[model samples]
Target: MTSKRRATSVTGNIGESVLPLVAKQHLGAINPLDILPLNASSTAKSPDFRVRLHPQFPAAFRNVTGLTPNIAFNYWPAESKAVDTRGNANGSVDRAIQQLGAYWFGRHSFEPNVVGYGLVCCFIYRGTRINPLQEINFHVVAPASMSAQTSLLRRVRHHAANGGRNDFLDELKTDGSQSRRQLLDV
Candidate 1:
């Protein structure tokens, strides 16, 4: 009988490989996904990152009486500093990443308890044109308090450890903003 050779698979998942990096560097910071080179090509459909948080969060925000989650994330960037709108930093279908970063990243007094992980979930073709998104999508857990030092990765990890699915999706839906428009006005 002739013996046949066994073939080993050489596939890789970018999301799977990138998860740990996100958890370590961006712990508790807003928008860890933006930092990573995530793609939404045919190979990958879901967001590159996801922060699982407890359902019982937003106690403080909830107590605000009339504040809504949608309004908070969508318009808050307008009040504070805006992200880089240049073609290099802000590209099409990638503005979400910047929004996430500007919200919770470097905007806290203390660190958040969270862990992040990323990996390649799909096999990328060799020489495949990797199209960089305009604003890469960033998955993060919303923070308890707003400060300049709170780590988004740590917050997500803590939420995971503590049992929560407080995933924050950051992306840009529009192009005209106070900060971004200023650059255009110039």
Candidate 2:
């Protein structure tokens, strides 16, 4: 018999594959921004998706890389117990926040893009098939000085205040026990 950890890994992998496609399709319906997954290789550090600024952004928001996000995206199914494989003790949320903030800065400082705006959306779910996402938390991560890198997740005040309990990133034992066929239905 497969171990629980092994089973859980499989379920997480299934969710990892399916969620992005479902999200892109669902969220991209009104698609203001370019909805693109960050590629599987990037999952270790960066957020799952990249919602870049709309091409019309310049015309609408004065065509400048300013307060509005030149780049944005969601961190899907941010499991509370998630730990970074990079030897960091922090969970998935913290890791995503840091990587994204750094990416935002790289875009901001660079001339071709010269982006000064970004959004960090964190989703933690006790969610079921009927509600695949619950307590979806989104915060517009503003442009700060380069030195502000480490403070990424903390910048989202409510999340910081809430810690990893009850509010922001609630602990969830995801469908680790669910069969692969069952997970696919969701």
Candidate 3:
């Protein structure tokens, strides 16, 4: 059977064609942060990420690059587990934090069109580059255009913090496991 997981590598230029395609193909009606699978109390519905295009960002940008203007999503997970991957080595915690911080810098530095397309795609590329075994990929289908009604930057930062914590923990867990295997073999 094919692995339940999928992997993809995509590269696109900054231009108009990419914008609409990204919107139509990726950003449809879904919120950016809401990309995670939704589960909640009996009455509570699975939430969605609130995503929007920047109003002042100019429709002209659409024409300038001939691509969809850059789009981003806000995300939060209801629960997470912190696994220690740092093995039994000293400075593991510090190393994990440093790696995660570097990952975030790599993510935020991506320029629209110059980098990959949507947030998820860019993340997968970064993840694979940083950790070869742990590759992630997902896509959302929604067509509604949204307004950047609230503090977009703040929301993005919040999501980044939450996601980064999990990444740091996961890295430590991976490192610990690899170390264990090595010790067992020796």
The model with the greater TM-score, 1 or 3, is: 1
Query: What overall lDDT, based on C-alpha atoms, would model 1 receive against the true structure?
Result: 0.29
Query: Per-residue lDDT tens digits of candidate 2, residues 73-107?
Result: 33221111222121222244444444543343333
Task: Give all TM-scores, in the order shown.
Answer: 0.22, 0.37, 0.18
In model 3, the Cα lDDT at residue 111 comes to 26
The alpha-carbon lDDT assigned to residue 39 of candidate 2 equals 51
Q: Put down candidate 1 lDDT per residue, 21-60, tens digits, no spaces.
A: 4334433324543233334345323344433222222343
lDDT of 3 by residue, 1-186 (tens): 112233355343222122233443543424443334334345332222212433312354344334453344332111111212212222422332233223332344352111111222111112232343322222221111222212222333444577843443344235443211211100
Better of 1 and 2 by lDDT: 2
- Native RMSD of candidate 2 (Å): 14.2
At residue 100, give the lDDT of candidate 3: 26
**Model 1 misses residue 122 by how many Å?**
18
